[model samples]
Target: MGLFSFLKKKSDPADAELVVLDTRLRAGEPSRLDSEAERERQRAIARATAAKIDEIELAMASDIFDDEPAWGSAARHPAAAAPAAPQAVPAEELPDAAALPASAPAVEESAILYANGQAAAAESLLRDSLQDFGRHERLPWWMLFDLYQATGQEAAFESIAIDYASHFETSPPAWQPLLPGPGTPQSAGVAATESLCPVLDESIAPRLARLLASNAPLVRIELGAVRSADAAGCAQLLQALQTLRKEGRELVLAGADTLMTTLRPMLAVGDRASGEAPWLLLLELLLLSNREKDFEESAMDYCVTFEVSPPSFEAPKRVSTAAPATGSGDRFLLPALATGDCAALLDAIDAYAAGRDLLVLDCSRLARMDYACATALQGRLRVHTEQGRRVELRELNHLAAALLRLLGYGQETGKLRDSLRLYPHRY
Candidate 1:
């Protein structure tokens, strides 16, 4: 009989009788038909039943169920079934369907574009942003102000100043033109002189006097190297500054911040133990640098410390100088933007680095560097490094630093010659 026929006979009377006989054989008790031959027959029947079960299981595990749709074969073999068509999602149900990507702030974008030498685009964007968002934001206004001043747009600057004053209900910032563009030589008319010393002590009093008596109209006293000051030095420096002001001579205090840092710690409110020289000198420096707010605060402190009347704030009458160069005579100040043909800039740097083993380029005013200029500068600095000389690019703004980094200037490396050394801006 076929396997199906044999399985169908499981419910037959003969099959029931065999099952009864098997049960009796398994009991291990003597039966009326008990014999060795009967026992062997029962054992063989039991083995054949187990083999049939194993065969059924093996068939089920194979492809035997493929033709049996009643057993849900489609569910068991999903790959064989066709996929259902996708249903469209409602617009409201879609994730972030109306959300747009966030963009950089208008002021930041304009500034970066200006730095990258896209002055027209930068100015246009600033103007548009001023119209759309200027009521709520002040940065765009200030940026436009600086842009106009830098580009020498006096009429536009004045027009915006009027709008600024009317909108903010206050006086607008004055229009001060920026210094000559990058690579332009300093004018010969101003006889500029530099004084380099490590400390502002009593020993330098005679030199200070000479500076005061000098015929040169412009004198820059390098205070970056000054680590400490005494009462005598402070008083002497104060006297020279006063004399210069009385004579209407131009004075630039290079690295005044560094000296201020050294002086601030030695001073305290209601403590005049260190005398008024340091206090008075710091106040004078603040005044000469056109820092009225800082001067006022320090003046208040001086008043409290000395129990005497503090000097009144006086705006510097001289033409406002550029940001104080922060180092000695060897330092080279980079312009606000380095873009387009930077041949003159590179030449100026070469001239500055000619006599010095160390090249110090100050980027305190540097806002951005175009790709070509950055590449050229990288090459120049690389040559300087290869010659066993060190190059320090100091006080770099974040934007300028990012460009230099993109050009592979300052890389993480094992040797100093491999990359440019960058000092981040202190502020």
Candidate 2:
């Protein structure tokens, strides 16, 4: 019987026999069917249905797989028809499918593993991939570099750097260790305190002066919170910075780049008829931060605008030995990975956000966030945003940013959710 005929005759004697035979096989009993031809036909239909289910599942899960070739093309052309394949393209013109790098899966897998605290497994997989396809792919190599740096495996990082340079014929990534994990003890020094406020106006100058008055050798100012700045505020803050530099006090300008972004629009290159304080402050920030390239460019602009010599860029005399604090003050640091319900994380965020109008979640170390956690976090953020409070997620990795974007935290119209801000990691 044909496949469809067998399916249509559901109540036939042959169907009953097939059911009984399937039940017996499932129970590990030997089948004693006498009709060999009928049994073979039933088995063929079963295999076909199972294959169809697999195809359906694949199509549902991923867009890469096409079901038309298996279902439509086969049905349109009978198996008896001879296949036509006479076209021959030059070897040079042929697409090199095998040579194409398949790095996304490997990169995502390694990132998830590392985020989940499975560093060893992630390292092993990266090493194996490097051995298998490292010559053709640079992503795995860079991932391995990041892994080593994150894990503080300096020796292994150097070893890989040498190999990477030789293989890629270029410089490998620099070893910039991430901040210590949560609960890691601060080094033996006076810990830097949080910023005074989120906005940089005339009022913040006195607060900064007080901070400078303190005897602490290392002063960390959270400039990331400064969303706006005025001339008076900028001048005061610049004076304080100059004092700190002259006194040789260790200064850490957290979020200086963010402050520069806020200041850039206030000053035009060579059109700086006013707002000289902001320009000077920007130059000071670049100089103190040891950003020579940025300082040089701004210095040239300063000279053209002010018709005076700009300050010379100076390298930092001493580097602070203390480990830089992560997520100071109102900022909550998300874990390396967030999955499942994430109740504890949500609670921590609530506690941090309580009695505060601005909520900053530092996601620099957050490598991956599953759908469930992303949903939970989005619900919490929505409530906070509706209550007229601002929420900022800072330095999120690409993977977590993508998931948040998927959940509607960031929209395609260049606007985020109401009172919500997402600062994805740069490079």
Candidate 3:
């Protein structure tokens, strides 16, 4: 598994090794570089690698157990053995081995890798196992799809997507475009939901709204731990939201879980529902392509419809330079980041995260907001709507907000935003 690290560098060693590369030592004699002996050596290496893999595969194929055995007799033997690390997989992480509920055979045990916070390692594991798993057992297709997209492996993702679609007609989206806008479009070319609710920070409500609006076929609504200010009836809202999302839709999510709702209050953010502001300059790149006269002017109609300025980033800032202001009355700047400085905002977040007693960022002014920002942030981050729409800190400038957006955090104002923060419940 760690072998890929060895292959990353492309043939760059040292000057002493350079002369060794040019000469072929056959039977302790220096010969031409492209000699038969060199070709024979390479073929031998390939055969050894392949033979080694086959031997390991055969050994693994012999066992069908709930837990992998630590030491095998085959492993200790010297004559017929190839060095093989025992394939260790979490028993609980896999599906019930007693009953797969799946039509596939039990010849090779299929493993489901559930590494939250272990994203990088998971990707590497899946990639290396892909070719072998196709014939023996299905790798966690959903995860593979995610890993492919996160690491920018489009071709690999597409191949996996096709295989998955052929196996299960209505699977989730490929990992790319994980944080699409509330009104983003889907590609008909691939077999996937044009959208997904990642449940980490992606606001499912906004994604649901987009799916409902655009009429995308496949949808995944995660109802793990959604909550609202009305503590007693939070479950009902979670159920209702799912039902509402499912209505007039092609699929339904049916289940129960041990998840409990711990609701938070909706914190206020900035007033860039219009997606304006100078620091989010990359966003300006999109506006540069905007041909419609009403694109920016009318854009607020969607997100601004409930905007809240938030405060926070983690960088440090120097307030000597003034930041560009959004339309004035509706904007607030968090004290730490309000200078319209990303460096300062990140610094403040870093400080706060490290136990510094400080308001890392805040909205300096009072501003009106709509539901769109909260809902949009929730959808983008894939957090439960009730969970996603809250702002942890406040007062966002366009740049700070944009950085958050690019990184999948958001400021939520208005009712939806209100649903996020921790608050006292009403009767």
Candidate 4:
């Protein structure tokens, strides 16, 4: 029981030496992290752990657990044992992670490195693993997206976005809930609020019309008139939107217009209704999608029927007229024009008279015309009246007579001057 007491004493010298060596030491073991081989080993462990987690997530997403009949005590009934007898194998032969061969050793090692917090090193390794497993339809796209987004890797986001779109957009309805039906316009824009306007009265008009039909707490707007879509209708819609903001919901417009132009302060709706457009599916992502995403380029996939350029909205300046009538003297036989667009109507008239030197135009049956139409008519009269054969209105319908009279034009004397140009004409 001398110095040998702390060390288990062995009768022989060699045995004593072995006993001392085997005894547990008081000092903690030095970190094995510094060693290259040891570091690689830790990485392997981490990768395995991450892959296992991925497996669990994949199972949850695919509903494989619920789809499979419950087995053992996990079953609801009190005395349940195991799943009953025969198991049916899927036709495609589902990938069995438990039985799949180790096709990629480096990927497994890289996964380990990532789990060990050496994410940079693990990145290549994970890529390799993906390459090995990418053949399967279930290639862990979500996990890949999370990793890339977390790393702020733009290329990765683009690559993953493409894959995600392909998978979610093309898959059958059961597989992807967000894919739009046939004939819908596909899009991906940067800012949510900036995409509320489109030209040719196609953007806000139809959207506002549709909004009128929606039961959402927020207002849904559809554009009704092409002429008014840009100025008055747009302004009216914006004012309505301002009123809607205080209700705690947003304004959501569905159509071809980009978000910022369609929804933002460009129109000056003032107060609540102007604050935010209501929510449609993609628009709802303003609240639903938390992360800010950028586009590498404009996307060709989204939820709409058409992708229209912004320029086509400017109405044509020339007007079209029927061939000269043999009875230009009879003012009552004018044609009936039906156009919600004032500018187009005017343009057609201008073009018609411009081409034909001497002709008489009829407006007796002119039911109604919006501002653009009024503007166009004034523009044409300015040019034509000075040149002799000026335009004339004949059979004034009740609505037409009132419009012309209200516009400050009396049959022959008061010419159809551009009402908007000289005076601030209010609707």
Q: Best lDDT goes to which candidate? A: 1
Expressed as tens digits, the lDDT of each residue in 1-427 for candidate 4 is 2223354334744444334434523244344245678657656765675565555554454364332212111112223223334547421122111211335344345434433345466566556555556434222333343335334565765765666446433221111111122222221111012223435233455544444444443222322112223344445454444344433333323222233334333322123332222212223222221112311011111212123221111111111111111121212122234334445445545655654444333432232344445545655665676565544443232233333443444233444332111110000
Question: Relative to the true structure, how large is the alpha-carbon lDDT of every model?
Answer: 0.63, 0.62, 0.32, 0.34
**lDDT comparison, 1 vs 4, better candidate:** 1
Model 4, residue 62: C-alpha shift (Å): 16
lDDT of 2: 0.62
RMSD of every candidate to native, in Å, equals: 27.3, 23.0, 25.6, 30.4
TM-score, cand. 2 vs. native: 0.40
Q: Residue 253 deviation, candidate 4, in Å? A: 22
Error of 1 at 423 (Å): 1.7
Could you tell me how far off, in angstroms, the CA of residue 86 lies in candidate 2 after the best superposition? 57
Preferred candidate (TM-score higher): 3 or 4: 4
**TM-score of candidate 1 versus the correct structure, residues matched by position:** 0.45
Model 3: residues with Cα > 4 Å off, grouped in runs: 1-125, 128-139, 172-427
Q: How close is candidate 3 to the true structure, as a TM-score?
A: 0.20
**Candidate 2: misplaced stretches above 4 Å?**
1-187, 319-427
Candidate 3 per-residue C-alpha lDDT over 76-191 given as tens digits, one digit per residue, 9 for 90 to 100: 22234445565574221221112222442211121112112344555566556555553443334433554454345778777777775454333434232222222322211101
* Cα lDDT over the full model 3: 0.32
| Between candidates 1 and 3, the TM-score winner | 1
Per-residue lDDT of candidate 1, residues 1-427 (tens digit): 2334455556755456577776887997556556779767766876776667666654554454332212111222334333423536321122111111133266556656767778689889878877667665554666676667667787998999889768754456555444343233332222243554667788987677667766655555667667888898899888888777777665556567678888999899989888999999999888876778999999999999898999998776432333333334435667656877888888777766676687777554454677778889888777777766777776554445434654566663566533357654321
Tell me the tens digit of each residue's lDDT in model 2 across 1-427.
2223334556655547779988998999988864788678887877776566555554453344322211111212224333434436422122111211434555557655665567788788879888766666555675676567556798998999889767644555445444443333222223234573656778986677766777755566767667788888888898888887787765556667678888888888778655789999999877765678989999899898889998888776422211122355534656555776688878867766778888877664554567677888889877787777878776564445534654567442322343776654432
